[model samples]
Target: MTMYSVDVYSGSSDSIIQDSHAQAVIVKATQGTGYVNPKCNHQVELAKSLGKKLGYYHYAGGGDPVAEADYFIDNINGYIGTGMLIIDWEGYQNSAFGNTTWVRRFVDRVHDRTGVWCVIYVSESALAQVANCANDCGVWVAKYASMTWGSWTVPNMAVSSGAFKFITGWQYTGGDMDRSIWYLDEAAWDKFAKANVANPTPSPQPKVDQAKPVVNPQTTWTDNLGDTWHAEDGKFISNTALHLRWGARPSASTIAVLPAGSVIKYDAWSRGNEFVYVRQPRGNGYGYVAVRNAHTGEAYGRFE
Candidate 1:
């Protein structure tokens, strides 16, 4: 029997449950923003409970492509039985930031490190930008024309440098409502996984301070390890007891329990309230954190 897969922006627990017919699910995680929409770890746990093959998609954000790829690895390094790490490249332009040559190199780096197949997700227009390097990556073309959510097809877009023919999947609709079939089954996924190796001893990451793109002083960011600091001022701090609550009221929602040294980004202060809105930027999206416990004075310099 042909296996099927569903791709959804992370955080749509209900949608994934509704589309339980699919054998696998791809959760979208964008750079600079952090793991797509579903920001909670429990959401991931819920998806796995459905007994579906699980994977993640990184929404290709422009700018330092390598940095973006690293963000993805940081968040999803330990996820087990992950399928191909789909790189959704729809918004890419032909400009400097959208350079296909650089994009391909970044994709290679991610695949080399993750031990998973790297698939490209793009529309016709976006595909043109990466026409030259398309052959280096698998293709997941998105072509939608129907009025309803799940009815669409994968057009015969050009892949790599040749007449594009091999397409693994098609995204026929938008949002969590779309539906499609998988071109590869579990055995295929296993083969692809075996072909690649995981955690290929990443090249020494550049020191964040000495690195360019100088951190914005206005924005304070944090890493996955609860290491809090101001990216711009080059100040690092440690807060042993920081907790993140969802929503405005104290009782609204309680999300993550952050330990000391976790990296985070400063979002905003609740209107006239004492709590600051901080987020964990895992390249997918942002996770909310409270400022009450984030004020600890311990600090560190550029993360290596």
Candidate 2:
């Protein structure tokens, strides 16, 4: 008897709990938002109560890869069941924010941080966009229906990528009528859990600076380098350094500078032994900024 599996999309009910006989259950969370379907918490708890092997599936939105990954981490962190994270790339066709590069990058980051095998769930169209990276990771091809053809035909889809045997599993249908049996049993779940380690370390948390008094809305300061600084909100530190070279460094980059009272929006901040780090607005692929001379800026008040 080959192992069989069933993937369930839990809406708001514990129907999966009733179908506890399935060897493995893939819980479908939200798609595109980069967050686990809010319905997953209920399903996860229900699956736990039923003692079933569980894996999570996220609908890929293909948008800003880092933001998507952060959304996933924020929602699904600390899930300790079968420990497999599945990325559903089937809906990439209409994604305004989705991109193949972002999808692959996000998956790589998630796998590196979580130590779980990130599986790609894609259809033939999506396959073309992400096929380059598919072999690098496990793939769950959605061939559906006997009418599909060529490599997309169920059997050929599994065999098209020689990296792995035809397919690890198949999704024959939706709901309780599914015909395939690729679900993982409890013993298999144990084996998978033991084989994969949760990332030994959790992702680093953002840091905050406490040494400097929060600058008020209208204050000015100068640095050793003679660069002027101004505080509008007492929370934002602005550089008034004149004649400063404009370019990107490991710490800071030149951006379109606003006037003295312009409002600056920052996502994170850090203070090191030598410098303070401010997250820069990403443009043209640049993502962060480091203020080499924090002494020049004054704050109106700490960002509320």
Candidate 3:
């Protein structure tokens, strides 16, 4: 269904109402040199409140790509792994640095740190500068306020059917403003959202008893990262108080807020070392939480 979505920036309206027809929104949440979009959180929460899938972008400013990527990632960490962390590349302020290499560095850093795939956003003139990288990452080419056949000089066709080959986003225009259409249909769009955005802000978790087992009738519970739950019940002493989530996914709902030094009975589901599944303290429910990395036999969870 070629879904409709928008890309906004600091100049865009602070208050936004969810557009049911729009499947998602890509907001400019950060920019070069540690500058952040003031309304990033509000825009994200508003879009999420309206049930719209959300993504974020950073306006590159010809700086240290790695450092800039780190800055952007830090700002969007809450929304990290939720959707695309776009590298908005037009050109560089620093004549000394090459745009393509820096863009790749930034994108790689983002992916390495967040585990969510990054995308590229470039103007028509700037597309060629990063086209080499675009084939690896989905490219959001921005020629203008709208995308129409032959509207821009750059060809909007397939470089290849690779990871981000298809111009997944073509910025078509409306009301003299910027908007984009996901090239794939509804199912693919949804699938893309889930695959790219593994985490978002969680909802409130339901109460559960600490000693009860965390399980469901079925045994096929896993996440995009391939971490399985309902494996085994294990006891963990909290190295620090953590926020409990409804599920193992980072975007799960927060069910319990535990303070440091609290001992928790949890299922020892293994997914690297940052995420842990614990039975709730009050009900027979399972909630996810992140803890400090366990040392030797100490309990730990992944944060980065």
Candidate 4:
């Protein structure tokens, strides 16, 4: 069954729920790495009181995708695993507007942190820019029949997403408050709000002593600073003299100091920490370096 939802920003008042026929309420929570919607909390609370399905979105500011993801997660920490997470990909003042990988990286970071894949919101005309994300993230294609502000109506228009087999949501109307048609029922909406994990054992199975030996378990290594590192590949360039460390944290051991304008290749990166550090391949083990300020998107070095 199709359900209705409304998305509101700071300009909107709490009366949105009082005026709309929406069964769900998705509010703008954050933008870039800096701005949080001032009235977000109140709007969310009103929805909660009415027992409406909830959603929160981050408006991409065309900055460091990972940093922006972290910022969005940080502000909406309490609401994680409780509402549908969305990334609003728009071109207004966004520097990364045309980059295909921006939404991919942002949604990847969100899933890595919270175990919940986010839905990508983009206009129908800009579908190509976020095509890379179609495989993992759901698409919420926005295409209005006209620019007129009108009441809720079932959308008859078509949304063509090439790689994405189907859209999870469609924003069909635009005005003081935009309306969307969610292609899911209440139960399905709850499932999207839960954490998604791989190979979950539903119930404990009896151990067999005669079973064949398990092969190739996943391996993770902890650094001297007690930070865990995982294998990842990327190229990095230092804009200034930066410390190559022994771990992912800021307090990790500084292995070497790269001169300004240095370029290095990394084989791995670390997560679940305050800052994200890339690991450079050394003689036997690896060396770590801070790629950017995880919260502020201030890069010590640029990623290639």
Candidate 5:
């Protein structure tokens, strides 16, 4: 059976947990070394009094991982074996945000002190940053369907945890309060909280390499550069520097210059403005990148 959870911070009111029917309530306990959630102890006690499963998290301030971990452990030492330990790895005010090694050190220290591996919480786009932490810590991804407020009704959405074999928890929606789904039962949740040994680390993935970028193959076109380009829609990795533009035309303003080994997932490609351009559906509008000099038949990068 699926389990529901709600995560809260100092800004959250007690009524959120009091009214939530979620099976688990993860309370934010501390941030960096200076700030502690004043409502943390009260929230944990409230969750326990209601006989709900409990969790506590530390907000990473991008400080020294060992020092932050020590602060988190010192405050939540009593709840180490009982509540799920989490490290909130967001970019807000976090200097070491995308540095996976910082995350590794913090969680490793938590395990050293409490013998409990803390789960890493990050956005779906930042999954690759924490790929190294998959072995010892669980992944808690936050990807909302919409910011709209709603009941505990699960949205019709499916998400991948990138290189990680599977996600331990998915926070699917957030507005007034954040909601998540856990695939495991109470026994599994407790096992993760109380795990004393490190899990076997998996083989590391290449630094810039990830899962296959292409989805479907349609047709092919040979450019003047003698490079065969696939026509179907999918991801494209630039072997060299390329300029992304606002329009498919050369006269269009340059949006951003993507460096070598940059990856862009395009929705479609078209031959226009003396160039072959890939259309990237981003946000509300689309961004276009010239993949080849269409008139000269010169390919800009390898197309898969």
Candidate 6:
């Protein structure tokens, strides 16, 4: 079924739900590295009160996409009305090196954190910015065929862009604000209402053991726990609470919980290729953490 929503920035101070007939709203939740949309929480809360589905997007400025994705998720992850996580990828230069890589990093990280795969919002210029971006993510495109409030044809134009399997949204109107139609039917839209990891309390992540002593994969390394380590990179924990385990797997015993910004020294990769062996970055015992903490681009993670 066709759904409508508007993407707003800090300038949108009006009551979005009260002012429009849209079924959902995609508020700009964050920008660049540290800034957040002041009105986003209000919009989300208001949308929730009105029983409207809600969504959010992050303005992916030319920075680390992984960090930006985490920032975006941090701002709006647990909303009961959340329908989608969109990465606004329209203005980060013309398919620059590491652009697709960073976007994918962001997408995968958001999925890992929220259990929902995020969608990408792009203009025609950035439609093909990242190859395989839509393989795992839905694509929301912005190709305005008309600017008037009645311009429903723009959604058709957006579909012609070939940016997605189906265009999630088509920005038909632009000016002081932007508006679009989510191209899903009511049944499909309902599925999207909580489609992206809607579990209010995510089920406990089972631990996957990775304690194998790998003699060689890319480079040879010893399995000794206290072996001398080499420098691949430096990183610190960025999540609010991170689990420390007795082994290099998700199922390892939770030895401790390290708070956000804990400094960690990544020791090596586990045999399973999913967990990371880290030194006592938080003075916690050395065990393992998932290798997908891209908020700060942790080493042995999705991002370099």
Report the candidate with higher TM-score, 4 versus 6.
Answer: 4
- Model 6 TM-score, all chains together: 0.57
Q: Where in model 5 is the C-alpha error above 4 Å?
A: 197-304
Quote the positional error of residue 91 for candidate 1 in Å.
1.5
Q: Across residues 105-213, which tens digit of lDDT does each residue of candidate 1 receive?
A: 6677776676555767765435666565555565666643321223333322222312244555556544225555556657665444343543122122222344444
lDDT of 2 by residue, 1-304 (tens): 2344456554424553456455556677656553456677777677767666677776666566666666765677767345557776643233632354766787777766665656666543345556556444555555332211112112321213234323444554332233233433345444433335422221222222456443221234544543333322223434443111132233344455444433445444432223344444445542333443322122222232
How accurate locally, in lDDT, is each candidate? 0.50, 0.47, 0.56, 0.75, 0.74, 0.57
Evaluate model 2: give its lDDT: 0.47
Error of 6 at 277 (Å): 52
Model 4: number of backbone collisions: 1
Q: Write the per-residue lDDT of candidate 5 for residues 1-304, one digit (tens) a residue.
A: 4568988877677877886578899999999899999999999999898878989999888889999999999998888789789998876568886686899899889888888888888877688888888767788887654333245765555556776777778887555568888866787777777868444232232232235442232355554544333344567788789888887767879889999888888866654425667878878687888876532235666655
lDDT by residue for model 3 (201-264), tens: 2222223354665322213355666554444444555656677777665577777787866666
The C-alpha stretches of model 6 lying farther than 4 A from their native spots are: 92-98, 147-158, 161-163, 193-304
Better of 2 and 6 by lDDT: 6
- Model 2, stretches more than 4 Å misplaced? 10-13, 34-36, 92-99, 146-166, 175-180, 183-304
Error of 5 at 161 (Å): 0.9
Worst 10 residues of 4 by lDDT: 198-207
Flag the better candidate by lDDT, 3 or 6: 6
Model 1 is weakest, by summed lDDT over 10 consecutive residues, at: 293-302
**On residues 1-304, what C-alpha lDDT tens digit does candidate 6 reach at each position?**
4667766666665664655567777777887777887777787777778777667777777677677777777777665244667777753231333365777888788877766777677754456665566666766666543222243333322134464555556665553346677656555554444545332221222232356432121222455553223223445454556776777656778877767766556644432323334444445546665544212113332221
- Give the Å shift of residue 170 in candidate 3: 0.7
How accurate locally is residue 225 in candidate 3, as Cα lDDT from 0 to 100?
Answer: 61
Clashes of 5: 2
Candidates by TM-score, descending order: 5, 4, 6, 1, 3, 2
User: Against the true structure, candidate 6 has what lDDT?
Assistant: 0.57
